[model samples]
Target chain A: MPNTLILSIDAMGGDHGPSVVIPAVDIAARQLGDVRFLLHGDQAQIEAELAKAPAARAASEIRHADKAIAMDEKPAQAMRRGKGSSVWNAVEAVKDGQAAAAVSAGNTGALMAISMLVLRMAEGIKRPAIVASWPTMNGISAVLDVGANVESDAEQLVEFAIMGAAFHHAVHGSTKPTVGLLNVGSEEQKGHEEVREAHALLRANSFDFDYRGFVEGNDIAKGTVDVIVTDGFTGNVALKTAEGLARFFGNELRATFKSGPLAMLGAVFASGALGAMRKRMDPGAVNGGPLLGLNGIVVKSHGGADAPGYAAAIRVAADLARSDFTAEIDRNIRRLGAVVSESAASPAEGAAE
Target chain B: MPNTLILSIDAMGGDHGPSVVIPAVDIAARQLGDVRFLLHGDQAQIEAELAKAPAARAASEIRHADKAIAMDEKPAQAMRRGKGSSVWNAVEAVKDGQAAAAVSAGNTGALMAISMLVLRMAEGIKRPAIVASWPTMNGISAVLDVGANVESDAEQLVEFAIMGAAFHHAVHGSTKPTVGLLNVGSEEQKGHEEVREAHALLRANSFDFDYRGFVEGNDIAKGTVDVIVTDGFTGNVALKTAEGLARFFGNELRATFKSGPLAMLGAVFASGALGAMRKRMDPGAVNGGPLLGLNGIVVKSHGGADAPGYAAAIRVAADLARSDFTAEIDRNIRRLGAVVSESAASPAEGAAE
Candidate 1:
């Protein structure tokens, strides 16, 4: 028999709350074996939905939570009065050792803030980062620090590199991912001081992953590297900008195909191929964005994710929990700390000698 | 008879040099009335290409230059040794008042460097910004500082807003353009100190355009504003990211349409609509990127632009020359100086009282 794994889920989060959560858990339960869920939400609502999903009812243990944080609530406000809330308890289960991982589809800012507070930063990590899976020409590459810290220094960027690579290995099954530092140009002297400094650091050390020097914004979709590391501000803008362009193109393409009867007939004949392309580009296919650099595993699904999308997020959480993701982070972060300290001590040690 | 406007051309620049430049001028001569060209390059090559285009030959005067800067040359190297190169002569014509504006499909760095060294910055402008005409759902919006300034202070960002707004008005014919500061979020306190400060300044001032406060990266293609002002670093990344995604989606769509026999037939029938959509998204259609904050106008076309694309850049230079772009900038910049000075003096005057 496979080892039984317990997963905590915030059933009162996201746009549809229990309605989406119960159905999503059912999908996840059907796909993943020997996995049990600790569902935290309103008992009546969760039970009403779980009754319709017999598999989900059999695998889930309900923990009644009367309070549910609003999707638009401020991070600080959520922190102050979020005790006993479904999202809060779901994360708490991971910290309490009752669950191997926690998954939630809720307010991004509040979820990140809560995850940081509950799990705390992993040893030697100054800041936490959110990592997104970007679909590329070759395959999916991981992009990190998407929106955790708006501003990051050289060391923080290095930390992101370490955590992002480890997370990619766990979720995407890359044994040793190749990482890249995002900049305006591929040249060493192209970007600002912090990026330059991070480049120097990444070049000096020999980590588990290969550190490709520098990559531009276009390199993200070109699949130039397995892990693309950047400060949260630039990464966030790039992510949202790509999403916006995709929407714009989709709308324009639809209008083009509907312009004339000939175009409409062409679209009908091309429906099979077009449907396949849409599936490849679908956001739901790769829905999970794991909050990296925290002490415990927590995945944040898109707030508007469907049942299948939420299930995809659950699979990500399960994969991360089964792998040595935390240990990998701890080892790399320790190496980084040593490198920084060694550089710091080199001049002083030379003087004494 | 219309008033004659002269445009200086870097005929020895870009991939095709005189062959593309002469044909492009021919196209422009047919489209725009009362526009004369001063071609700067090797006289023999310019004359050879001019033989094929009678309209351009009649309207053009060749100013032969012995040298041309290499596209990959460093900015400083070009500045040191680029005295009588084709790009240098092109800008010098504008500086000497022989040409109202200059156009180059050459080295962006060398051209910008030469333009800055020769024409110099405008009276109140600190640094020059390159403004790109971005294709949007509603129409085109002008995005500025795409790769000119790596980092911008709050004041420089405001300068971009003033220059960018004036530019949109000049080129796109927006009588009262709307401007937005590109930020991580629309919330007042979302971004870093500089963006926040820039937002505050834009909101406080009553300028020639309507200040739309802050816009995220996605708002660019959505046509949320007429002018989107950003620091060069963020703007460059965003521009490249969008272009990369566009290429990615285009490739995927083509692959989908060519996957099977039915799809191939559909592609044939829908070719007209697809061709029209392609034209809308073509980079050549909006090929010009004007270098703003200079004493005279200078537009940079894509290095690999064909004849028609090069002509588009020429048309942009012609439009700016005919419009009161410089005067509009001067009016708003003087107002900005007064506002900055007033704010700087308010506390001092109050303390003295």
Candidate 2:
């Protein structure tokens, strides 16, 4: 059936590596059928782990990659030297059309750098942006440019908005996702000169997505905006800060729940409720983030992700592949390109420009 | 006794205005001895609210102010037109030496703009920075430049480091607080050119404070560094994200604890534990943030603060006034200024420069 969704996963990536990735893959494959995984890493370690699970052994294939990219290595240097590294090899599988998508829980910088170099940008993408979704009070909100292209111009940010909107629609099933430009204030004249200009550009462009105007930092979790866009620097800081606070709150809740007999009894009785709360708050459910505006699929799982987290990433890759999201983005990009070209020739005419 | 630790509070500010501020002042007066509040606002409204509180009737003084600064108004325009506004009058009290410090839960932009215009920058200070603190897993970390200066140069960021360090030491009672430059990576060479240059400048200026090198987003909750410094844009986004996540988590917990009968039982037993958790996670505890490097003391409380939150702001202002934090900062600025001047004159002789 159109050659079962094949994912090339970096086995030696993340904090726990094969120990976590293997179990996660096994769980995902067991739950979701018609999925094949090409696990790339050292053969011996992977085989040793795979030997423990018959289901995993049957569902996955091993591809050897002798090298691993160090977390500290510079992205450019790592890409230059790591010809056979797990990250590079996994990306290569996508490039060679052997795999529909590539997943990595390794060094984010290396992954982004390799994806850009190997898969290259989609037809009209000036720069690919990293987009992630955060658990909000209502549901979830997607934020883009979280460490992709650290220094982006107005045009790059506009591209990020387009990609981010498409991602929300593809992944979250959002129809006409509201796009917002993140700024210090919601007022039109509030942010830096770049933000003001980007605001004008987003407004003038008559894209399929719903442009919701500017959004503030506090509005992120309020679920007021569907897709929030910003430069990589601000987006990165915002994402990490949300992550830090989530972890902090989790720790505090756990500590408080085990403080005394009353708390322990409460936790026991509220097990069902607590389980529901845990599921809602767990970062694992929202573990994978797609690198948008890329020609091929690349999903970066959390670096500290466990087996369950990795499993989620694999499912994400499969979903994107099944929906032909890349084809959709390509068509949209070509349409946008025509509009851009015409605008340049005409100087100022058409709402699309 | 010591002028009763007079605090000039903008009673006409914030979402709830004197309704919240008056009750907070009343509570603080009854709770903390020898604390006098000079409340500036519409005299009639202030008195009407003061009459509601038994303690406020005797403890607070109502100072008449004819206008109020709107939250969305331009900072410079607000300063020029709002001379008779409560926020302006509050700062005027500090300028006239009637109050030790000025506290406002009003428009942060307006507060900083007026504070800079009226109080001016400290002798060696090129720009004043807004510093905020939030509860982290490892206690608290102070983040500076939370929307003080939108665009920052290398020198401004370095000065932020020094100012943030002094703030942590004076307010948080830390001895030789460690200062870190907030970046995307912990590596020395990572981040923008400005961040890299700032890192070197911080390391070179031995006379300023203890420079703990670079820190990333995840390090914020780790409390590895006491004072984290960055530009206003990054810092503002980070602070707001953290605050938003905390609220999101708290709401999730509450919803889960009220799901069913079992959840209700758990909530009843865990009431004490839940209370403890709430206390720790309460935004009020970290209500007010000082606008550092200004000649006079100015504290900006959250705009959404309620009575208890306003009380926390008042207490913070009073404590800062008693500590003579401004004088400490001024003295350090002189030392830093001398070092900067000497290094400039010698060109290559200074050890750190």
Candidate 3:
């Protein structure tokens, strides 16, 4: 077998912590034999949870970190202050090449800050974006910059589109992902000046991926497009809205079954089908979102995620490691750089700093 | 009981036209006994549908219009060219004092354009905003300028917040509505430069209703606050995203219950609860969005709405008319203008034109 895909997990993160993370990691390791985990957190808490799974303990190793990052702390300040935090330590493993990837269910802002501060952006990346895959009717559609960079210009949006397309292809195994800019309307000249200018830039580029015009808010869940690109502000709103609606729908479904006898009977008959649908729509199944365009692999799990959710996140990290996504992204970046350099007078090389 | 709330219905505006509009009018006229409708559209088509509803025919009146506006035409160009269109006639009825309010499930852009052109803004109002209500767990929250004025400055956003607050109170029956500025974060000092300045402006005028500081995307549907305010671009995205999720949730629920026999049984038992849930989440029940701050009453319905949905729009328009929303809005506008005048010098009286 190829060398094990080592994933560094921030066990102290999330509401459930090692109680959920330990079981989830055990389940994932058992299912994917080639995967091993470096659990980073307080050694005592992690060991107490892992004690239940002696076999998993033998399969995985623990890397203790004394401190943990609080969710509400300012991302930049916390990264500077929490030098020994589990999130920081987990990311450090990837930066030092101790692990192929890192997974955290801690503060998203902190994760993004530490990832950027430590591993830095990959070659040709103007800014790193957070990309999440949401389950859709057709399959799954990937939305980028959900909350990474809140304020982005037209160039950054275009770059996000390119990165999103590449990430979708790399992770989902799609040949030519159909990328679209999320907007109020699908017309050629809709949306604000940023979107309008970004549309022009994206259209002019000769990327191998298919730029499938613009998509509306409703199109994301319908799975109409494979990759949806937007500024972090809009993208974050769309993602959160989707999550909120899913919760609302789940509550509504539960309420529907409890109304009366006839309805209760109807629900009984629909339990199996409903269960399947629930599984498909389960956020846990689509738990992890890769922090794309980073130098090292880092995945951010939902803050409220449980053991099964953490396990799924580990699976996503392992899959990225196995697929050589970073290498592919690096190659595309260089290709993009060459194209950009030839067409336009390349901006001064040191412009990013 | 009270003077019937007169609502002019553009019977020829929607995709289905009189086929949907007439039946919906009839339903509203019967359900809401203290309401009357003036249906304006193709004489023959509307008459044909109205003939089917004997009771509604007796209650509601029809005013014929020779032409209808197509969805694809430019809003201004169409309104200018198609002077005798149903939308125009309906607005004319409202302006002429023959109808208390005008409601249309027509081309949204056309409706807004014509409403602004014909009715104009209220005397002290700078711009007319299209305000829509988002259904939330707490109740309902109003988001303004879904697509009224695309590019807005700090002053305009402050104006929107003021107008949106009045609207929530007038229509939603919200007392002391908590008005929030929709930003990327809840901090008073966050968001783009324009939003940041607007936040300061709103904070300075603390006497103007209950200003609840800032809110984010997730808060819109949670109904954390009563009135959520944002510029047209962000507001449009939030409104559309919420609508899309509602539809997606419905479809997912249906698919989940219909998968197999056991699932079917489960759905049967859950049917009553589901119906109650669906009732609460139904878009048709919350169909109309008033074009607030206009000199005359105008309500816009969703493009894809059906008869039942159209009926709800009529009810909303009637409710607004009966509640003296215009008078309430006018009072607040004057109050706000007085406060603004005191804080800063009045902007040369007629800066709006």
Q: Which candidate is the best by lDDT?
A: 1
The C-alpha lDDT values of all candidates are 0.86, 0.79, 0.77
- Full-model lDDT, candidate 2: 0.79
For model 2, how does the per-residue alpha-carbon lDDT over A1-353 read when each residue is reduced to its tens digit?
Answer: 38688889999889888888888888888977898889999999999889886677888999999998886677778879978999899999999999999999988888888898899988878888888877677677788888875567666777887888777777878877888888877777666767766677677667767888888787788788778898887888777766666666667768877899999889888877776676666433487899888889999998888788788888878878777576666665665666555554322222110
* Maximum-TM-score candidate: 1
Per-residue C-alpha lDDT of model 3 across residues B1-353, encoded as one tens digit per residue: 26767789898877888888888887887898776778898889888998898757977788888888997777757767868889999998999998999999888888888888888888788877888877777888887778776557777777788778777777788878898887767765455666676677677765446888878777776778888778776677666766665666678877776766677667656655665676676433477888887888898887778888888788778777777577766776676677667767322221100
Q: In candidate 1, how many Å is residue B301 off?
A: 0.4
A195-269 per-residue lDDT for model 1 (tens digits): 878888888898989999888888887888999999888898888877777777777778888999999888888
Best by DockQ: 1
Q: Candidate 3 regions off by >4 Å? A: A272-276, A282-285, A334-353, B1-5, B31-37, B50-62, B149-151, B269-276, B283-285, B334-353
lDDT comparison, 1 vs 3, better candidate: 1
What residue runs in model 1 are displaced by over 4 Å at the alpha carbon?
A282-285, A345-353, B282-285, B345-353
- Binned by DockQ into CAPRI classes (incorrect, acceptable, medium, high), candidate 3 is acceptable
| lDDT tens digits by residue: candidate 3, A37-98 | 89999999999988997656977788889998887877767778878888899999998988
Give each prediction's DockQ, rounded to 2 decimals: 0.46, 0.44, 0.38
Q: What would the per-residue lDDT of candidate 2 be over residues B102-182, giving only the tens digit for each residue?
A: 999988888888888888888788988988886667777788888776668777887888778777776787877788888
